[model samples]
Target: MSTPVLGNNKRASCGPGNGIRQNSLLLFLLLALASCTLVAAQQPPYDVYPEAKPPYYRVRYEASGKPGELIFPVNYTVWIPPQCETLRGVIVHQHGCGEGSCKSGLTGAFDLHWQALAQKHDCALVGPSYEQPQSADCQMWCDPRNGSDASFRQALTDLGQQSGHPELSSVPWALWGHSGGGHWAGGMVMLHPNRVAAAWLRSGVPLFEANPDRKSIQPHELPEAALKVPIMCNPGTKEGVTVKDGRFAGVWPANQTFFAEVRGKGGLVGVAVDPLTAHECGNQRYLAILWLDACLQARLPETNGHALREMSLEDSWLAVIDGKTATAAKDFDGEPLSAGWLPGERIAKAWMQYVNDTNITDDTPPSAPKEVRVVDGELTWAADADLESGLARFIIERDGEFLANVPEKSQNPFGRPLFQNLQYSDTPVQPLTQMRFAIPDGDDPQSHRYRVFAENTAGLKSKPAEVAP
Candidate 1:
C-alpha cells in the first residue's frame, strides 16, 4: 500500500521527548509509537461493510486494468432523502486511504449527522468504497487524476438515474474527505470547483506545486474561478504542530503548505487543528457539518437548474491563521489574505470550540417525532435532526410517561453521544439508529397509548408525538 507522506518519521520528535540519548531515548520512542498505535486502535477495525438498504441505492464498477484507469473495483452507495421531489446537490463523504477507511466509506451515506445536512438542503449523500486491498497502491485511487475522477462522475450519472433523481448528475457538491480521501476531494475541487460548493479536507490536500520525486503524482494549478469554492484543511496537532515526529506527522506540513498557497492567493481557504487526535477523526463531523451547511445556504441555486449564488466577502468573519478565536474580517488586525476566513460568526465560534476540543453545543431542542404510530409491535416515528446538535436518543413514553431510551447507554467512542453511533470516519456505525421502539408487553392493545420524544446530544428534549389509536 502507498503510505501517506510521513513528513517526519522520527517518533521521538512528535511525541514526549525532545532530546534523549541512551536507554531513555529508546523508551521514549517506544512509548510514542505505542501511543499512536493505541489511539488508532480505538477505532473499529475495517471488517466487512453492511448492505445497502432501501432509500439507499448502490452501483458498482470493476477495474478496467487498463493504463491510466481505476485498477480496483469500487462500489458507490447513495442515499436520497424520502419524499424529495428533486435534489439540490450531493454530499461526498470520501474516506481516507487504507482498507479500513475504504470500508468506512460504505457507511458514509448512512450517517444521520451528515444526512441531516443533506436532507435540510435537499441533497443526496454518496459514499464510494474502492475495493483496494491492504497491500495495494492507494495512489491508484486516492489521486483523482488517476482515473478515480472519471469513475466518480460516472457513478453520479448512474446514481442519478438509479435513484430517479436525474438532476444529481448536474447538481453542485459539498465534499468532506479524510486522509487520502481528503487529497482526492481537494483535487476534485481544484479540477471541478464550479460544481463543488465547498470542501472539508481532514488531514489531506492536493499538491499545489509539482514534486520532482513523485513521477506518478501530477500537481494541480490554482485557477481564479476555483477561489470561489470554500475549503478547509484540518490536521491533528501531533502532525507537525505540537508534535513533529511519527507516522502521519507530515499531515500538518502538507496542510500548512496547501493553506499558505491558497490563502496567500486570497483564496477562500481556512485551517482547523484537531487538538485531541493524531490522524483519527475525533468529533470533526460536528464542525464540518456546520461549515458545509452554511456554504450550501449561501452557494446553492434558488431553482433546480439555476446557477449557484455568489458569496461576497464584504461581511465575512476572520481568525488568525490557525488561531482559535475569530471576529469580523474588517476588524482583523492581521493581513487580510493570510487570515483564516470563516463563513460567518456562528461557524467562527463553533470553529474555536472545535479547535480547543470538539465540545460544540446546541441550545435549542430538536423537533419532536412526527407521524408516530404503532406498526406490528413497534412504535415508529419520523423526525429531523437538530442542525446544531445531532440526535442522541429517543425517549419512549408510555402514555406520556418516560419508559426507556432507545440506546439505554448513550455512548460515542469517537465523540459526543449520537443516536446513529458516530464512527471514526464521521459516519454512523453498523445497524444504523432506528426511529422505532418496541411496544412494551403487558399493555392492553386498546387501553395503552405511546408517545415518543426526540433528544439531542445537548440533553434537550423535544415535545412528544402521541401514537395514533
Candidate 2:
C-alpha cells in the first residue's frame, strides 16, 4: 500500500482503489497517518549538534505558560571536568541574537579549546540556546531583566540536580557574550553584581542611558558593587573606528558610550578594539578566553558560596583610549582613572597583542599528548590545548623519524593556525579535530614505534608522546 504525507511544504498524492469501503478507507488513512513522517514536527536545527555524554549534561525548556516569561523554547548544555568533587564557578559562552547565532550555542559546551579553560579553573562551562526566530524582538531575551534571568537560574538548579554538581547553582559566573549576548551579560553585571566574576562584551553592549533611537532598550544603573567586576568591551574597528558608514557603524559608538559610562563611575571596565574585521566575530574569542582566564584566576571566590574577590588596582595596567599597547600602572604617566583598566600584567600584555592585531604570539609550547594507543591500523591520543596559543596540528613520528602531520596543512582563514579550524561561533568546526593517525600499510607495522607531538599556533612543538609497541 502507498501512503501520502505532507512535509516541508510538499504534499504527495495517493491513488485510490475502486469501490473501497469508507470505513476501511478511514482505517487505512489512520494507519498511513501513523507511519507517515511530518516535517513540521522535525527536530530543531540545534539537534544536529554533538551529543552531551557523561561529564557533559544538557537540559531543554518550553516557554513557561505564565505571562511575561520567555516566549521561545530554550536549551542549555553544560560541561564539567571529570573527577571534580566541587566546582568553583561557571563560565558562560553566550551567542548573539537570530536563529543562526543562537543555534551555534548548541555546540558551545563541546568546544575543546573552551573546555580547557573550564577544566583549569574547575569551573563548569554552559552554552544556552534560545530558539528565537529571525523576526523576534531581540530585547525580549538579550535584556536579562526580561525573564531570562529567572529562567537561567532555574536551568542552573535543574542542571545541578541532573549533573550531581549542586554547586553549579551557587557559584559565580564568568560571562563571555557576542552581540546581543553581550547585552545580557552586561545587564547581569548590573543586576547581580556579586554573582558575576567578570564580563566580556563583544560587538554589543547595554546602554547606561536610554537612547531616543532605541527607545525599547531599558537602561541599567551602575550600582557600586557592579563597578568592581572586571569588564572588557570588544568591537571590530570597521564598526566605527577605521571604516565607518556601514551596517555596523554604530557598534563602536555604542561600545564607547558603555565604556565611558562604566569607567567614569569607578567601574573596572576597558575597551579592546578588534582592528581587523567588522560585525562578524573574527578572532574575538581568542582574546575573550584569555581575559576571562585571568579574571577567573584572580576573582573566583576562595570558597564556594562566597563573595567574589575584589581585583587589586595597584598592579593594574593602563592604556590610553587609542594606544596600541598597555603600560604597567607603575610606568604609565597618564591619569590612572581616565585610561582603560586591565586587570594585571599578564592580561595587559595579552590585551596589547590582541588590540594591535589579532595575532597573539605565544612563547611556550602546548602540553604533550598522552594515553597514546594504536588499534588495528590507526593510532589515537589525548592532549590539553595551550590556553595562550591554541593547538594547531600534531606531528607524528615513526621510530623517532618524521612520519607525517595529522592535518597536512593549516586551514584557518581568520588568523593563526588552529587544530580544529575555528568557526565564527568560537567552536571547532564539526567532526571534532581527529587525534588519529593512520599507519601506512606499505610500512611494516611491528617495526614502527609511533610518537605524537602537540603543536601550538605559534609553531612551537611539545615533547613527543610515544605509543607502546
Candidate 3:
C-alpha cells in the first residue's frame, strides 16, 4: 500500500483505535443533534397546548365488574388531542338507551353528531353506552344509577391515563346527550359540577322536578360555582307532549321553571325552543355544533337582560365561519351575534344543503304581517310584528299544505317570554299552533312537500308563502 502523505500536519495515523474513536465521535454528535430536534418539536408553542400533537386522543375502555348485576357494557369514544393552542375544548357525548348493552346500533347513532364536532372544531369527543341490567329494579333504559353514568366516567378517566396527551388532564369539557342520553348528561352536570364545565340538555327531564322541595335533590339544584359555566336547555318543539295517558301533556311548564332556576344563578342558558326539527341527531348535530363552539371557543359577553328571555329579531348576527361569536358591535336589537358571526367562504358551496335548506330562523318578527321571498339566491322572509303578538309565528307548511306551526308568545325574538321564576300577570300566553317542520332543499317551491306559515293573534296566517329558492 502506498504511504499516506501528511502535508504540513502531524503524522497521519491509520491505527484502528484512532479510526474507531473518530467514528464514535461522529455518531455521538449526530445523535445529540437529533435529540435536540426532537425536544424542540415536542414543546408546544402555547401553554394550553403543551404537547407536539393535536391535544386530544380518541379511545375506548371497559368497566371492571360483573356483567349481569347492573354491569353496563360501555363503548367510549374519547377525543382530546395533543397541542391545542386554541381554548376550544373537549365535549363528551352520551348515547341514549337503545337495544342491548355495548351494541353497535345504539352507539352508531351518536357517530354522526360526535364525529361532526371532532372534525369541525378540532376537539375531542367521548361517547359511552350505559348497559342497564334486565332486572326489574334495574331497567337500564331509565335508571340513573344503572351503571351507565359510572361507566362513561370510568372511560373518561381511563382514556386520560392511557393517552399521554396532556390536554385532557384538566381541560374544560361539556356533556351533551339526547332523549335518554340527555337525562344522563343532566345528571352528570348536576352531580359533578366541579368536574364538568357545563352541559347541553336536550329533550330531557329536569333534575329538581324528580323530587321538588326535597333537599336531597342536590343534583338538580344549581350550585353557585356552576354559575361560571353554562347549560343550554333545548327542547324540540315537535317532541310531541309528554305522554301520560296516551295523550300529550303539551310542553311542560316545569321545564321552563328549571331553566329559570339555572338562569337565576347567573349561568349561560340558550334555548332553541320550537326549532324547525324534532328529537333526532340532525337537530342535535346542528345545535350541538353551535353550543360546543360557544362553550369552548373563547369567552362570551355578559348579558344584563333576563337569562330566560328570547334572543332579539332586530339583530343581524355575525360569527366566525365555525359559528363562534366574534367581539363586534351589537345590532339595534342588542344582540351580540353580529360580533363573532363569521361564515365560511367556501362552506356555503361545499355544504350547500345547509345554506339551501329551509330551516327556521331564531329571529322572530315584531307584530306585523310577515312576507316571504327568495332574495339573492337565498330563501328570505320578513315580518313586521313583535314575536308575542302572534303576527309573526314561524309556521311550517309543505306544498301549500299546512304541516306545523310554532306560535309566538312574547315580544322577544325567541317567541316565548322569559319565565322570571314568577308568573307573568299579562295574558298567560297561548301559541296559535304547535306543529313545527322545515322544507328540505331540492324541493319544488310551488309543489314542494312543505311550506312555512306565519299568523297573527287574529288567527290570520300568511297565504301561499314560500322562501326564496
Candidate 4:
C-alpha cells in the first residue's frame, strides 16, 4: 500500500519527559470525556452526525437485551444528494468484521466516487457499521438471518424519518460488502432477493455446504428468487489460489462454491478475481461502481416512486471470457451463453482491465491549471474538468514535499472530497476553473517551490504545474 502523503503525525522536536507525558495523557482523557458529554448533550442518545462535512446524517442503535452478550450497537449513515427531489433507489456499502473494518463503514456514505454513481442514478448511499468487537465471532452479524438484518431495516426507517427521505424505506437496493460484510450482503440478497437490484461480494461469502463441526453458523439456502438478483463475487488472487495457507485462504473457495451453486441453478452470478492484494480493497471500486451503475440502469425505474423495472436477460451480455484480453463478447472464442449475464460494453472492458492488473489504467488526467499564482499565504489556480472521470480533487506540494489538498476540509469521513455539486443549483460548489489553498503556517511562500496536481475520480494523479516563488 502507498504511504499516505498528508495527515502523517510528526513527533514534536523536543520529546516530553515521563512526568509531562503522564500529565498530557490525563488532560487528553479529560478533554475527550468533556467533548463526549457536550456532544451527547447536543443530540439524543444513539444519534451522531459524524464530523464528515457532507450533508448527511448518522444514527446509532444499541443492541437489545443484555450488555455483556454477543449483540452490539449498529451505526448507520446515509448520504442523500442535495439535488435529489424524489428518491429512486439506494446503494448500501457494508464493511467487514473486526473493529477496524466496522469503523471503516463510517466513510462509506461519504465516498465521493460511490456518491457520484449514486447521484447519477438518483440513489441514496447508505452504510451500516455493526460494532462487533475484535474477539467476537463475525457470524453473529455477518449472517443476515441474525439480528443485523433487522437492525438494517429499522435503520432505514429511522434514517428516513430523520433525513426527511421516508421513501428510502421502500426503494430497491444495490449492495456492496467487503470480507464478512460480503457474507452479510450475499445473505441479504438471498433472504430478500426481490428487494435487491444487484450485489457485489468482495472476499467473503456465506458457506452453503453444511459443516456439522461448525454448527453455530447455519448454512444458507439458495432459493429460486435469489437467481433474479445480479451478483458478483470478487476475491483477491493471493487469498487462496496463489498463497495456499494464507489467512484469507478460504475466500476464493467460498466464492467459488457460491458461484458454482448459484450459476448452476441459472442464477445471475459472475466472479472477478482481484489480481492485487488479498482481502484489502484495491481498485475494486472502479469496476464495482461501473457494474452497479449498469445494474441500476437496467433495474431502477426512470420515474420516482414507481416499481423497479423487471430485469431482462436480453439486456445483458452473456459471454464466458477470460478477465484478461476480453473486452468485447466477440473477443471470446465461444458464443455468448443464453443464461450467462454480463455488464455493458464499457463496464465489461473495465472489468477485464480490473481483473488483469487489479487497477484501472487511466492515462488521461484533468487539464492542468492555468494562471497559477501565489499571494501571501494563499495559492490559486484555474483549470478545466476531466471529461472522463470528472475532477476528484487537487494535490498541493511545496518544494516537492506534500503540503495540502484543495478544499482542505474533508468532504467525507475518509478525508476525501467528492467536489461534485451539492445544492440543487446544478453547479459545483467551486467552479473547476477556480481553486485556492492557504499555505501551511510554517512554510515561507516566497522561497518555497509550490506545485498543484489534479486527481480524477479513477484516483489518477496528473502532471504537476509549478507556481513561481
lDDT string for model 2 (20-68, tens) is 0011111210111111111122243333555677787877766554555
Candidate ordering by lDDT (highest first):
2, 1, 4, 3
Instruction: For candidate 3, give the lDDT.
Output: 0.38
Q: In candidate 4, list every pair of residues with a backbone clash.
A: none
Tens-place lDDT digits, model 1, residues 301-405 = 988778778777876888876678888997888788888888888888999999988888778898998988877887788888887788899898776677899
TM values, all candidates: 0.87, 0.87, 0.45, 0.71
TM-score of 3: 0.45
Q: What is the C-alpha lDDT profile of model 4 across 321-368, one tens digit per residue? A: 224544344454553442235666666667777777855656676667
**CA displacement after TM-score superposition, residue 73 of candidate 1 (Å):** 0.8
User: At residue 53, what lDDT does model 3 achieve?
Assistant: 27
lDDT of 3 by residue, 1-469 (tens): 1111111111111101000000111121011111110111111110111011232333333323443223333344454433433323457665443322122222221232244444445456664433332221112422345455555544445566655534444454567755445556666666566555557765553455443332222235656656545565555444433332211122224345555566555444544443333333333333445555544433222221212222222222232222212322243233432122222222112122232231323333323223455433333454433222224355665556655545424242222222110011111112111133334456554555444555543345545455544
**Judged by lDDT against the true structure, how good is candidate 1?**
0.75
Instruction: Give per-residue lDDT, candidate 1, residue 330.
Output: 75
The per-residue C-alpha lDDT of model 3 at residue 18 equals 7
Error of 1 at 60 (Å): 0.6
Q: Where is model 1 poorest over a 10-residue stretch in terms of lDDT?
A: 13-22
Give the worst 10-residue stretch by lDDT in candidate 2. Answer: 17-26
Q: Is candidate 2 or candidate 3 better by lDDT?
A: 2
